[model samples]
Structures are given as C-alpha cells and as structure tokens.
Target: MALQIISVVLFTVFFSEALTLMCYNCNTTTECTQANCSSSCSSMTNHNGNNITFVKKCADSAWCFNSSINLGLIWMSSQCCSSNLCNNATVSENGLSCYTCNDKDCTNRLKCKGGEDHCITATGESLQNTVKGCASKNICDNITLLNNTLPQQHLSSSCCRGNLCNNAQKMTQGPVLLLVPILSLLFYILGLF
Candidate 1:
C-alpha cells in the first residue's frame, strides 16, 4: 500500500510538473514572438509602387517633400512638411515615407494634380514628423504628415539579468517545480482519505 501510494504520488507530481513546464514554455514562447513581431514592425519600410522625392525648401521654415505617383487614373502629387527644421527624413518606393522635423511648425500639404479630382489636404504638428502619400486607381490617398518613431526600450532589464534565454529557462523551471510538489501533496492527501 505504501509503495502504491508513493508511486501514485510520484506520478501525479511528475505529470503536474510536466504540465507546468509546458504552460511556461508556451507562454514565454508567445511573449518572445510578440517581442520579435513588435521589433520587426517597428522597422518596416515602404511597401512598393510609389515614388517620393525630397524638397529642400518650402514656404514655411519646416522641411518639405513632394511625392508624385501615376496610379492609372490620374497623376497625383502631395507636399508634406516637417513640423520644424529638417532632422531626419526617409523616402521609399513602397509608398511609405516619413520625415522628422525639429518643432511644431511641421505641416503636411497634399494636392492631386490634373483630372479635376478635387484636391485633398491633411496636416500635422510634431517635434519631428514624417508624411506618407499614397495613390491608387480611382482614388487618391495622401497621408500628408505621418510620424515614424523608434520603438521604446522595454526589455532592457530583462535582458540585463544575465542571459535572457537562460533567465527565461530558469523562470520556466520554477512553475514546473512548484506544480510538482503541490500536485504530489494533493494526490497524497486524496490517497489517504
């Protein structure tokens, strides 16, 4: 009877420990994937099928750019301005562009040239800002001023704790060990009753 009780307790403990380890692995894996996803998306560039150009001077003291594209319906053009003076700017062929200005004077202005398509305009103010202009057949889309920001640092502390992978592994082991003893105690009491 004692042998049977010990075996049952060991089995229950082992099973619970295994389950706890699995849960921890799954949760941490998901967290790691999300962190990676956020990292990747933060660095995403333009998509494709767009042309952007940089303009040195504008009516305002802010930096500006003119983006033009032929999207099969009409030729569209957009002028985007940085809130302040030019600091950093990026233009890409993938229809994604961004500019950063120094202050709040950054304003983005867009216009659809030709075809009587009724000009569209949008504006923004920022310490540093960017703008995206998009055009498609039958529709003219202009993201006058858009902001491209760097990702916030959140994982520094976690990473600083020795190796992140090793820490995660150690954390995962805790839950497994915790569940094992709890399950063993529960099983032992049940067997006693």
Candidate 2:
C-alpha cells in the first residue's frame, strides 16, 4: 500500500507539470489568439506621446510582475499573471505618477499604470544616461530585472513612493545635506580648544 501511494503521488506531480496555462497572444491592436505557457501570461502596453500599442503573450514566472520602463523616447508597461487566459487588454491607471526622462527633457509627467506604485530612477554607467518612470514594488525590490525589459543593461536603480519623487535634484543634493551637520560639529570642536 505504501508503494502504491508513493507511485500515485509521483503520477500526480507529473500530471500537474504536464498541464500548461493558456494565454491570449497578440502583437498588434487586432484580434488575439490562444497560446499555451508553462509559467505565466503577460500583457504589455507601450506609450509614445499620443500613440499607444499593446502586446499579449506567454511569459516566464520570473518575469511576472507589473512594471513600467522609460527609455527616453518610448515608455513601456507590462502586467503578468499566472492564470489561464489572464493576459487581457486592460491596463488601468493606478493613480500614482512620476517623471520620465527624455534626451532633451527629464520632466515629462507619466501617470502610473497597472500595479505601478513606486517611482524609479535608473542610471547607466554615466549619470547623464538616466531614465525615470513608474514601476511596481517587485521591480523596485529587484532592480536588476529592469535590464530584461530595457534595450540597455548595466543600470543601477533607486525607487521611491511619492509623487514625482524621482527628481534628480533631490538625489544630488542629499549627500551635500548630510555633510552639513558633520562639518558644523567638526568646526565647533576645533573652536572649543
């Protein structure tokens, strides 16, 4: 009986692994078809000025989260789920907002969408090459995952949870502000002698 129970458990596990989740697959703004995935389903929305595009397909679970990316000229947002046929064309605004960077300007206002609750500031090798936008908390916790969604890699990121909190000036001035009290204390100690 014990041997039979072990065999049944193994069979159940194998059967579950064989079952795949179905997702809606589409690239254009046209009709979508069914696609099978072993992990998760994904829906991605790309916004460029007045134009908006949508893409739906199967994705890996490791990439399953709502995240937004801004690469200067273009901004893309993706939402992922682990249920069958869960990749729908509903990318709603989450009421949070942040700033997006462009080659000419870094003050473009971006409305957070899907599960984006945090503002992200991602910088490349040089501080000059920076991208700021809205992101989900999952992406904030694992900033390296942004490389998968971006055209470029080697980006370090910082996340904040407030309106337009990714402003560059605040981040640059933070270190200088910290030195103020320390410098004052040192001068006071020198004068005491």
Candidate 3:
C-alpha cells in the first residue's frame, strides 16, 4: 500500500499540467485574464507619431505582422512568442524614420517600428491639427475608406515612401502644396467593433 501510494503521488506530480498563464488584457478598465498561451506579447507602432501598444497572451505557432482588418478598419501589428508574460515588453524596432508631430507642426522626429515602412501626413478640417507618423501601406492605400469609417468631421491622409519625405512644410491654402498621404485616422476610432 505504501509503494502504491508513492507511485500514485509521483504520477500525479509528473503528469499535472499548468492551468493557465496570466495575461494583460486591454479594456476600458485595466484587467487580466488567465489565458491558454505559451507566450504573451505586445504589438507596438507609431500612431499619429505616438506609440500605441496592445498586449495579449498568444497561442503556439504565432508570428508577427502589421495587418489591417476591414471589418472594423482595425489596423494591428502584433508580435508573438512562447514565454509566460513575454508580451509585456515593447515590440522590436523596424529601423525606419519619419518626421512626426501631433496637433502641431511636423517638427518632431519619430522612430518607425515593426512593419511600418510608409511615412504618413494628415490634416483635419475641424481640428486643423496636422498629424504625422509612420504607417503600414494598407492604411495609406484606402484613405477614403478610413475617412468614411471614422466620420464625424472631414479628415484627410497622405502616405509617402522614402525617409523623411514628410519633413517639408505645406501652405494649407493651396492644393498644389499638399503632398503625400495624410492619415487622419483618429477622427475617432474607426470600426469600433
């Protein structure tokens, strides 16, 4: 009986599996969820020249990419790995540079991280604040759709290739002065679904 008990205890200890991992979940209120994930990680990017990050615990075989979801016009860049609470850190940088400023002239410099290869410039009718930053090509491609998706006021976006292409100043009164794609993406959250 003693030997049997020992064997049973050993088996239970060896076969017991961890229930779940703690993950930082984004919500209106700060919350955490026990998730079945081998890794926890975050997605990071410059939005209107400011860094935006989202954290989530990820399953196995996860990879990273900057992708746009048309349903809610959700643009996401996610990086995943296989470690507990691994998503807590900032995503790796992608070595791209662009001029950046928010609610002001584009005088500040921004570091483009992840899959953001295109530089974006934007101005809105109501706010009249010029926003500049780096973005994925998809966000730059469908400016009309983006505007329509988040329409309370008129917004405009211009996307350009090459480093620091958005560094130049524009005379707002002239159409000929506007260059590249401007991303007024935050007219409000697009596709809030």
- Please provide, for model 2 over 14-83, each residue's C-alpha lDDT reduced to its tens digit, 9 standing for 90 to 100: 9886797989998776789998789888887765556777788888776455665543345566677888
Q: Is candidate 1 or candidate 3 better by lDDT?
A: 3
- Candidate 1 segments whose C-alpha is farther than 4 A from its true place: 1-54, 60-67, 71-77, 93-193
Q: State TM-scores per candidate.
A: 0.16, 0.56, 0.52
Q: Between which residue pairs do clashes occur in model 2? A: none
lDDT of 2 at 43: 81
> Taking the tens digit of each residue's C-alpha lDDT, what string does model 1 give over 93-186?
4322222111222222223232222222112221122212223212222221111111121101000111111111111111111122222232
Q: What TM-score should be assigned to candidate 2?
A: 0.56
Compared with the true structure, all predictions reach lDDT values of 0.24, 0.64, 0.51
Write the residue-wise lDDT of candidate 3 on 39-80 in tens digits. Answer: 444433222223343445453443343332110112344444
Among the numbered candidates, top TM-score falls to 2
Better of 1 and 3 by TM-score: 3
Q: Best candidate, lDDT-wise?
A: 2
For model 2, the stretches where C-alpha displacement exceeds 4 angstroms are 1-22, 29-31, 36-39, 47-54, 60-63, 70-72, 125-127, 144-156, 168-193
lDDT of 2 at 154: 48
Worst 10 residues of 2 by lDDT: 173-182
Q: After superposition, how far is residue 127 of candidate 3 from its true place, in Å?
A: 2.1
